[model samples]
Every structure is written in structure tokens, then in C-alpha cells.
Target: MVVAEIAEALDVRTWQLQEAKDQLSEVIETAQVRGPQMITRHGRPRAVLLSAEEYLAMTSDRPDFKEWLLGGPKANLALPESAFKATGEAKVEK
Candidate 1:
């Protein structure tokens, strides 16, 4: 795999698909030590290999939809009086 010299500055290494596949262990080790390792196919970026710790750190704090909705600032909306006045078109009652 051709290691991208430019990516070195970012502490990331780019590996060709075949090279990364052939040396999967090394690639994983590199990701663990150096941050993220980018995998490329035909010179285009296809994926990134990240250490488990890095992956967890990136995803662990994300809240689910319900939690996110509940955690947001409360809205203090005031509905118009007409909104509470139901039209007598429906028969359902509490």
C-alpha cells in the first residue's frame, strides 16, 4: 500500500485496499497507535479504520432520539384559545 505522505501531517495513514487487506493486523495496530488509517481503492478514499477506543469515544456520547428530544431546551409556546375549542365534527370523548 502506498502510504500517503501528505496524510502523515494529520497523523493518519492511507493504505491501498489490497495492502491493507494483506496486512490487516498491522493496519489495525497502526490505527491504534497513530489515530485513523484511511483505506483507499483506486486512489480514492473508501473507508477509515479506527481503534476501538477511538470508535467508542466518537460514538458513545451520542444520545438516542428520545433522549435528545428530552435534553433540548424546553419550549414555552402559548396556543391560541381557538386551538382548544374543538369543532363538534367528532364524537370521541374522554
Candidate 2:
């Protein structure tokens, strides 16, 4: 979900969040203790607070992503030769 939706779920006014500044440690601790925080500035939410675990999951490698994408649609869609010229060969075919 977008950070705005998270703010709404947490019942926080978008403008009520604090400025991120250099308070990452404080923000993270506060967020962990109080759920995610919304960093705001000039009365607008700017960023989100995610736990280290959450962050790791977000940035973590998607082991099955390629497989998932390739397995999707399960149909062949032909493309021009020029497309492969820049995109490289498809390791798997439909």
C-alpha cells in the first residue's frame, strides 16, 4: 500500500507526521513501538517508517520473480527482432 494509505490505516493525519531530519533512529524506534510513522514537512507527509524486517523484505531478492513473470500469461507474444537486439535473449520460452 502507498504511505498515504498506511497513514490512514494508522489514523494519523498526513500533516501530523514529524520531519525525518536526522532522527532515523528515533523514528525507527518510535515506529517499531508505535507502528509505522509518517515523516512530514510543510504539513505534508513525505516518507514512511518501516521496520528493519519490513525494509529487508521490501529490498530482498525475489528468488521466484523471474519464474513468476515467465510463467504468467502462459502464451507466446511475438516481438520484432529489434526488441531482442536491446533486451537480450529470453532464457525461457513460452
Candidate 3:
């Protein structure tokens, strides 16, 4: 879901957060099982509580630019022998 939607779904207002300070265990538990928990301040979203596993999963290794380019679409084109000549337009086969 989108960030705003998720925030609305698991929103914790400023005062509510203060009240739940002693019971943060529940917050942490819910955040882990139900996705990110949003903390709002003055009606604006301030922060989020995400499980470590989820955080790590989001930040996991990914292919670098070179690898991505190499793995991209391949073009199997045919060129005439004189295509590389210095004087005229290259002849390319469709």
C-alpha cells in the first residue's frame, strides 16, 4: 500500500504515542506482524516503525548498473560489409 494509506491504517497520534509508551511492546509486535506503524505529530506523519526483517529485506543487495545493462534486452541486428565505411550512411538490415 502507499505510504499515506499505511500511515492512516496504523496511525499513532502524538498523545496516543505518549500514552502507549509503557506498552510499546504491543506497538512493536503489531508493527512486525502488520507492516509499518506510523507515528503522527500535530496531524502530520512523522516517523514509521518497521520490523528489522522488513527493513533488511527492503535494503537487500541488488544488481548494479553494469549488471542491469548487461542483462537488458539484446538486439540481433545485421549490418552490411561496407556499413563501417567512413564516407556514407551505414546499411542496416531490419
Candidate 4:
């Protein structure tokens, strides 16, 4: 088996997207101020700009948090022996 990947650009879809025209220095700053950017070519929607962190988190594989909490197994289980040692009656506070 063989695997190969060609360099392809990312496509962001939005109602409209204006071409990004700024120095690398300003890209981050602009996105921060604009609150997620929209990209358009000519007069149609194309893509959106996102902060690096946002993009990473969005694209990254997020664990099934709730599933993880219950992952190992499920069944009727009892508390540990130490817990049972407490006894049915509350200890009389002296």
C-alpha cells in the first residue's frame, strides 16, 4: 500500500470573504480585532479567518469527554470496603 498527499489550500466558506491583504505581522492582529474574519473573492463568499489557537482547537481531535468519564465499564458496583466500614448509623458526635 502507498499513501500520498498533494499540497492543497484550505477552503473556508462564509457569506463573503475579502482577500487578505496585509503583512504577516498584521494578520494575527487583524483577526483578533475583527473577531473571526470573512473571506470573499470578487463578490461571493469563500472562507473565514481564525486565530491560530481557535483553528487548532477546532480542527484537532477532541476526546469524547463525557464518554471518557464513563469509558472503562458500567455495572452495578458497590463502594469500597473502607466506605462500608463507616456503618449504617452515624457516629454519635461527642
Candidate 5:
């Protein structure tokens, strides 16, 4: 039994926190079959439950920060000497 109707424009189902807690299993099952289930507290969105496949699909193809930085095109632009001048009042000891 569907506890709530799907919000067609968003393609998601929303449930009040209490309602979701009361029907936790059903919510999880629906998340697995449907796309995502939104849980709201006091009529305000609080969380979303997604199937394992959906979560993996959403995250698996994305690169990590390090990988993203390494994959960017190389730049060979030159800067003026003043660009390297120290602007701090700290002294370096060797």
C-alpha cells in the first residue's frame, strides 16, 4: 500500500517523519522500487532515501577532488615578478 502519492513534477514521494517511522520497511521497499523517497519533518524536507543501486549510480562515475585537479588542462601562463613577492611580515630561517 502506498503511504503517499508521488509528486509527479519531481518524481519523488514525500512522507512525514512520523509516517515514515511508522512504516519504515514499506518506505525502504518503495525506495528500492521507486526512485527516491523524501522524508520531511514538520512539513519541511529533512532527508531522502535512495536504493543502493541509485546511490551507487549517482556517485560511482564522479572523480575525487585529487583526480579532478590532476585531470584539468595544463596552463603555461607567466606572471610578473611582483606576483611572487612575500606580502607577510614573517622571516624564514635556514
Candidate 6:
């Protein structure tokens, strides 16, 4: 695999994900000490192997959708009462 080119740029270990599957334990150990380990398929980057601590550190404290919207700028506008008005039209015709 063309891992050398990618690894040098990112300063991390690179592995062809399929070829490296047999040595997954070694990959995990390396990621714990060396930050992220890049995984590639068909010589293209596909994923990263990260330690649990690192994963949690990166993902923790993420805001949910409701919290995200609530934290944004408040709108000054209000819904118009006319928006709720019903149309005085017939439901059906013969």
C-alpha cells in the first residue's frame, strides 16, 4: 500500500486497513501512544484508530440539537395571530 506518503505528511502510522486487520491489537497500542493511526483502503484514507481516552476527549461535551439552537442568537419576531385563522370554505362538493 502507498502508506508511506500519507504517514509522512500526517506524522503518524498508516496501514492498509484490510491488510492490518490481523494486527489490530498492535494498531490500538500504537494509537494510544502516538495519537491517531491512519487506516486506508485502496491507498485512500478511510478511518483513524484512536485511544478510548482520546476519542472521549474529542467527542465529549458535544451539544445536542436543542441545546445548539437554544445557544444561538434569539429571534425578536413573534408568530402572527392571523397565521392560525381557519378558512371558511366547504369541505366537499357533489
* lDDT of each residue in 1-94, candidate 2, tens digit only: 7657867888653433444556666777776676656777665567677777777878877658788788678655777667776788764445
lDDT of 1 by residue, 1-94 (tens): 3446656666688899999999999999999998899998998778999999998999997999999999999987975555556653444355
TM-score of each: 0.71, 0.49, 0.49, 0.37, 0.71, 0.71
> Where is the poorest 10-residue window by lDDT in model 6?
85-94
lDDT of 6: 0.83
Local distance difference test, per candidate? 0.84, 0.66, 0.67, 0.52, 0.82, 0.83
Evaluation by lDDT, superior candidate among 3 and 5: 5
Q: Model 1 residue 77 lDDT?
A: 92
- TM-score of candidate 1 on Cα atoms, chains taken together: 0.71
- What number of backbone clashes does candidate 5 have, counting pairs of residues 3 or more apart or in separate chains? 0
Candidate 1: Cα lDDT at 28: 97
Write down the worst ten-residue block by lDDT for model 5.
Answer: 1-10
Model 5 over residues 1-94: C-alpha lDDT tens digits? Answer: 2334435556888989999999999999999998799998877778899999999999998999999999999997865455556554344334
Off by over 4 Å in 2: 1-8, 12-19, 59-65, 76-94
The lDDT, on a scale of 0 to 1, for candidate 1 is 0.84
- Highest lDDT model number: 1
Error of 2 at 8 (Å): 5.2
| Candidate 6 TM-score to native | 0.71
List candidate 1 stretches off by more than 4 Å.
1-9, 79-94
Q: Which tens-of-lDDT digit does each residue in 17-91 have in candidate 4?
A: 223654444555666665455555665445566888788878788668887777767776755555545776444
* Preferred candidate (TM-score higher): 4 or 5: 5
Worst 10 residues of 2 by lDDT: 12-21
